[model samples]
Target: MTHIVLVIDDDEERARTAAEQVTDLDWDTDALDVTVLHVFTDNVEGATISQFGPAREARDVLEAAGVDVTLAETSGDPADKIVTYAADEDADVICLSGRKRSPAGKAVFGSVSQSVMLNSDRPVLFCPPE
Candidate 1:
């Protein structure tokens, strides 16, 4: 059976790192399928390939690992879109790079990682930035 892993990130390097970490974990022996999702909340028209550089980098990482990869982009709340995509894809796991933020920071800016972790029914892997 093939397991689908969803990797979400706004930055190219962090997205790549998250996918790499998932590959390193060896969570399952079955074939792995990965989808790197990027959510554009606003200025959707302005979104360019450069904005999704992270998704592309992540695709390379997963592809190099022999995992089938699909990259997707959409416009919506980042956390909501991530959770919805996981459900829509029947993803086995959702992985993302988590930033260490202070309580005030989280309260003020809100944390995408936190929202996804709380909202997702599937297992969420928070890979701290290295």
Candidate 2:
């Protein structure tokens, strides 16, 4: 069966990490279809997915690893959009980066990763970020 993976990418390091993690999975690369989703909070410069470094990196790395990859873009609250998109795509799993945050910082400003993890029915894989 084809397994769909939704990678919510926002930064180059995290995007590459998530893509690499997907490649490392025991599943066959041919059976895995990955979509790198980037939610735009602001696009004052009129940026597109092609112009985004994170999405480009994810696509390049995954493709080089022999995994099918695509790029998707949207504008909204990242957590909500990620969950919605995953469901829309019927994704088998979701991948994203979790920044190291202090307890107080997390409490004050909720994490998109944490919110998605709690709200998404699909399994979520969180990679590392600075």
TM-score per model over all chains: 0.86, 0.92
Per-residue lDDT of model 2, residues 10-122, tens digit only? 66887788777777778788778888888998889988988899888888988898888878889989899999999988888888888889999999998999999999999
The clash tally of candidate 1 reads 1
Clashing pairs in 2: none
**RMSD to true structure for each model, in Å:** 2.2, 1.5
Q: Among these predicted structures, which one has the highest lDDT?
A: 2
Q: Looking at model 1, report the run of 10 residues with the lowest lDDT sum.
A: 1-10
CA lDDT of every candidate:
0.76, 0.82
Per-residue lDDT over 2-114 for candidate 1, one digit per residue giving the tens place of the 0 to 100 score: 55555565666677778888789865534667777777877646875345778778877877877888777777788988889888888888887877789999999999889
